[model samples]
Target: MAPDDIDATLGAAWHDDSPWDLLTRLCAFDDRLGGGPGERHAADLVADELDSLSLDPRIEPFGMQRWTRGHTAFSVHPSDERSREFEAVALPYSPAADLRAPLVDVGHGTPAEVEAAAVEGAIAVASTDSPAGERHTHRMEKLGHAVAAGARGFVFHNHVRGQLPPTGALQFGHEAPIPGVGVSHETGAWLREYAAEDEEASLRVDATTDDGESRNVVAKLGPESDAEVLVLAHYDSHDVGEGALDNGCGVAVALAATRLLTEFDLDSQVQVAAVGCEELGLLGSAALADSLDLDRVKAVVNVDGAGRFRNLRALTHTSEAMTAVAERVAEESGQPIATAEGPHPYSDHWPFLRRGIPALQLHSRTPGGGGEWDRGFTHTRADTRDKVDPRNLRTHAMLTALLVRDLSTTDPDRVDTDALRETLREAGAEPGMRAAEVWPPDWD
Candidate 1:
């Protein structure tokens, strides 16, 4: 493609409203929680959009243990027959529970912290935020630690102050042994003070688990060679919010990019997947990898963070070749794309990365401390359509389209397993992985 042609492509892309329009359509759903009605609607809508591009999209189905949220209640008791009730929401996969136990603070809820706190038979409370210089802790890992410590219940409170109670899964594809709930920062503060004075707590959670089906929306274009590029973004989000910023942005951006890429005749095939069940722990992408020929995949561009912020966070995942390409794209587009230097297993990219695939994790990197800003609103009820800027969506749609176009022939570096093991170990990810039961025995 000539400079003028490239210029024309990007220029037209800048004003495109397809991404923003798609974002609105996606956010219109009540919630895209794994197998919920909202998710089913969103999945069919995405397939219809893909079919419009003549890509012949298919819904690759998979079975999963679906979790449905139910009513939750929590209170502190200072005396018999009287209690102070607080608002809370059950974390996904929490088992039905009606329990009273001493509330204990397991600061940050790292395995060591929970174990050292000796929270046996107590209700362990942990913050979602980590102190500076400490590796970030995941909610599932905290619940794992709490369960292992013999806690009867778990409490995850947001560090960011919003009345919004945080919600995330307790585990992938299964129910937790104990109940877990999330509360707002204010409620958490009240709990800390009341736990000191009251000496007892009561938490009740009611939920249901059942077998269900989910899918990966797949489409392909360009040359039908043995090697191809995989462009992935999940359409599923948690039941707590509109999911606009959490993943609706990524899916919308992917759809928008697909619209633009269809106009160009490329040298390599691009397989687009708007996968499901990611919010429940990447089941769709895991199923996709298990059912496909990964050896035929040349590179992967997993978009989980594309449209939330203006500047794209083109995380190279320690691949020097991928990093070089990101820099080239940044320089050519006159846009600065920031990069991080390690592999992360928290998103759809991990299913591909586990097999040594070189993947670029595209996320929205905000101005200050990267993830803190993004997560301040993402997982909670505050992650509505207003948080997503239309300007950012269009810019990402164009840049990601350009990135996928370039990655078609970059011959990106493959991750080394030994290096991946060591890096994850040093980054304090192995313990959490093990806690969540996701650590492969072979990686050890």
Candidate 2:
């Protein structure tokens, strides 16, 4: 088929009002964790829609160690004997802890300060800023330092406007040893001042963990082929936000691309994965990565937080050859490609990268070096569909279709493993990890 013919078909499929309505309806379903109406309802609705497309959609069930917000309330007591004033909402996944211990003011929770302070069993109030460094890295390091210093809990003061605290699985790949939460800048500042003035500050957090099953919705186009291209997006959102730009937009692009691919018969196969529990330490992607036959997989193109902006940001841990391929596709599609260093831990692509598979995470750039839009709205209730740009969505879908079509048609055997190995070694992945592991039996 001609390129213009494909463009026309994709334009018609994506430009219509139906795609927007479908996106709106999907966004409306609350898919937050912990027995909320969103998760199951959204999965069911997506499954129904995929079936309507005459595609074989299946819900692959898996267990997730889930956390939910239990009864939680925090208050600040002033030294002048005024009644306690509640300062901030407890973050999701906060551990259950009750201590009236004296508060300590630690600026930025750095290693040196944490080592210097008497912080055992005390609520550590810290600023979320670095003197002169990468703010996200510095903040995460501070969090780790606080948890190590025997601090019972944390109160992070938001330094930037509209900033929300980090929540869910404290460490990216492991459980956090202590419960942590974020407070508004005003609350954090007051706590800091109260501590400095020798006034008492106290906080109590209540939370719970429930064992439950979450699912990865898989829709495959084409027959069982040895070589496959996997496309992914997370369907689950933070408890507070609707997850429109964070992922609802991504889901829309993936779904729209899948629909377009279905219209044409192809030599190779495409697997669309709508992952669950990505907000919780990339659980869904980890599960899917463990189950796949990596030897036969050609490449992984993850569409996360796409179609909401004009710029196209492509993060990859793939070979330069693969990067060149992606760059070529972006050039042809009239999109600028922003390349980043290997494997970002924030999205579903991390797990695949860990397993030595070539993977890419595609998203839009946030203004003023704020990282990404979802980072701004992460774990907050303000994330909604109104933030999405339909033009961005259409462009992402078009690019994805072109990339998948090209990769699927290309011979997997033609890929250069030696060059790929060198690339992985330079990227710090140990040799032999690129060899796909044995597929886990009984992928339940």
Candidate 3:
């Protein structure tokens, strides 16, 4: 992008409040779970915004077997005292189950630790985060390991406090073999204490499983070209909170950027895609990858971490073109944007990245940053409208507009298959992918 164009875009971005308005509209819905009404509303909002720009937007709907939450009961049965029950939520995709077994604390619940503890016939408990110097452990990995070891059930505790219980899916688009639930940080500590002495625990989870549908809003901009740049965000959020941070912020930022970029000329088209069902696993994007012509996609920039903070960073995933643009934009705009060269199969970008496409997962730079995986308040009940700042939205929209413009003109150095696999292996993504059953994408 030229300096003249950069200044022009910045001038337009300084006074923009449209992103905050879009975010407010998105936050009005309590939860945007995949295949739910909230997600459909969000998808329609994005399409309407794009239609206002004369960009012919389309909603691509897909179907899947969905999970509906019901009552979940968990209690500790000490021999000498009355049973104590705590508040918890059933993990999505957890099957209907009831069991009473010994509660075993498998700290971090890595595969090796779960095996060493001999937790067969017991309900294994694990933390949301990995140990110091260890890669972040996902809830699905912990749950999968427990079931593999013949554990009757699984309990995941949030690493963050303030009574927030982390909510994520058990298995990708399928009923998990055993029951799973999440508890607050403080409650998990109490459970560990109880495990040392009176370890008996009884758990019951009930739910209605059925078929459902979800939609993705997609719009095309700029003149037709051989390959296009994919700008992506997910409209679906977890059922636990308003989802302002995890993805509401992301979709809003993407809309604001698309609104401005409609007027700019580009060498290639930019496809704005608001996918659904990311929280239940990357179901929407996975479906898209299976259907779209991968050969015509030059790059993918997934907006997942913007608008919550002032500074933005990109997980470049070994894409040289992406890393260069991130650094160039920060230097040119005088913004403190950081770039990480590793890959983690956690967000909407994973589908494209795994297929040797140049992919970037853009997120807010973690404040007081130093390899902290959890960003305090996402995926919990506290992820509300008050947590986002309007100023951050405008700033990110300007920077993203510039990044997309640059990617449109520059050809990406696609990541090699073996090297990409090694990068994922080094970043500890293999275990989580294997657990979620989304690993070894068709490209492998």
Candidate 4:
């Protein structure tokens, strides 16, 4: 296709209504927890769309440790104590336990805080907020700290206001050492004050765990080449919300890009991979990465948190080559893109990045740096379709396609494995990776 044809195609996509329509359809489904029916539906939907595009999509099944939610309740102790029963949700992979122990408020639940506070035989109540200028603490880190401090139970308090209790895994590849529950910011404040006066709080969580199956939807377009540029997006979501802003919008963006990219002939093969079980960890992406020959992968453009904001941002995972390509693409496409240099293992791109593949994770840029953007609705029930801007979704999809095209033609000569490893170390991702059990044994 000519430059004019490419421009026209992108312009047409910018005005297209299909992306938003697809977003609505994806958010219409319930709780896309890994291996659950909702996630299977999402996988089938992506496959069907790819099949319609004649992409001959393949569904690759994988097994993951799954947890089924049961009763979770939080209440203050002391038979006559005056305290309201705060609504709470169990953190994924937390084990079943019914304990009535003294609550120890450990501030941010840092290792230092857990050590300083009286956590032995107590339920540690920790804030979700990271200290100013400090890296955000991973959920598993807090739980691990509490467990090390001999805490009998754990409660993670949201930093943002509103009754949204943030949800994420306490640990990956194994069950948590203690039962964990998430409570709202208000509840956290109450716990802080109550702990100052009283001693104990009661936490009851009952959940079941098992190994279950999930899938990744892999489709391809354009001519086959020795190297492929991966367009990664995850289709699975948490059971707490529709996961629209968190990822449903991202899935729609990937599909929309697929629609536009199929219109023009491409130099290298573009593989559109919509993986499942992201919420449980980057399991689907890991499975996909394990199946591929890493040398054949040129670069990865992962839309894990796309379409949430107007300006698009990419985490280059400390790859200067990938950063250069993204900047060039943004300039060529006339799309504003913010770039960050870091290794974030929480997203889907990490599985490939960990293996020396250059990858870019696309996420929305929040203005003014931080403070409850998206109304703190991520992983909560309020993270629905209304939170996603249709115009932003359309623009992101177009730019994503442009990036894929540019990256597919780019050689992987610039990838520096040594520098990438150094960057991950300098960025302080090593501790978190070890805590999350993603640290490669060979790296040590």
Give the per-residue lDDT of model 1 (tens digit) for 14-81. Answer: 78777888888888988899988899999999999999899999999899988988789998887555
Report the Cα lDDT for residue 167, model 4. 85
> What's the true lDDT of residue 218 in model 2?
86
Model 3 Cα shift for residue 12 (angstroms): 2.6
Candidate with better lDDT, 1 vs 4: 1
TM-score of each: 0.97, 0.84, 0.96, 0.96
State the lDDT of candidate 3 residue by residue for 1-444, as single tens digits.
566775787787778888888899998986799888888898898899899889999989889778888899999998888999988889899889988999898999998888888689998989988888877777788887888889999999887778988888888777888988899999899899887774799999998679999988888999899999999999888898989998888988888889778867788989999999998888888888887899999899999988787788888988878899999988977888889887777888888888889998888865775354766788788889899989888888877887998899899987797888887777877876686676775535
RMSD of each predicted structure: 1.5, 5.3, 1.6, 1.9
List of clashing residue pairs for candidate 3? 305-363, 305-364
Pick by TM-score: 1 or 4, better one:
1
List the candidate numbers ranked by lDDT, top first.
1, 3, 4, 2
- Model 2 earns a TM-score of 0.84
Q: Write the per-residue lDDT of candidate 4 for residues 1-444, one digit (tens) a residue.
A: 899999889879868898888777778887888888989998998899899899999999998988899999888865465756889999988899988888889998776788899888999999888777767667777887788779899899988888888888787655788899899998898899888876577788999889899999998888978988989899888888998987888998889989999987689999899998888888899999999887888888899777888888888877888888889988988788888876767889878887788888888855556732233578777788888889998898988888887877778554566777677788676665675677777676
Off by over 4 Å in 2: 81-84, 105-113, 116-118, 126-135, 138-142, 163-167, 171-175, 264-267, 372-374, 410-444
lDDT of each prediction vs. the true structure? Answer: 0.86, 0.67, 0.85, 0.83
| Candidate 2: residue 332 Cα off by (Å) | 1.0
Give the per-residue lDDT digits (tens) of candidate 2, residues 1-444: 676777778768655554466679877775555335687777777787788788778988787766766665666667577746654555545667775666788886766677788787777887766545332333345556776778887777766665454444454333356666777666676788777766655666777766777888888887678888889888787776677776778888888778778765567888888888777667788888888887777778888867767777777654464577677787787767677645434578766664556776777776567553235554556577877778777777777777778677764332344554455455433311211111112211
**Residues forming the 10-long window of minimal summed lDDT in candidate 4:** 366-375
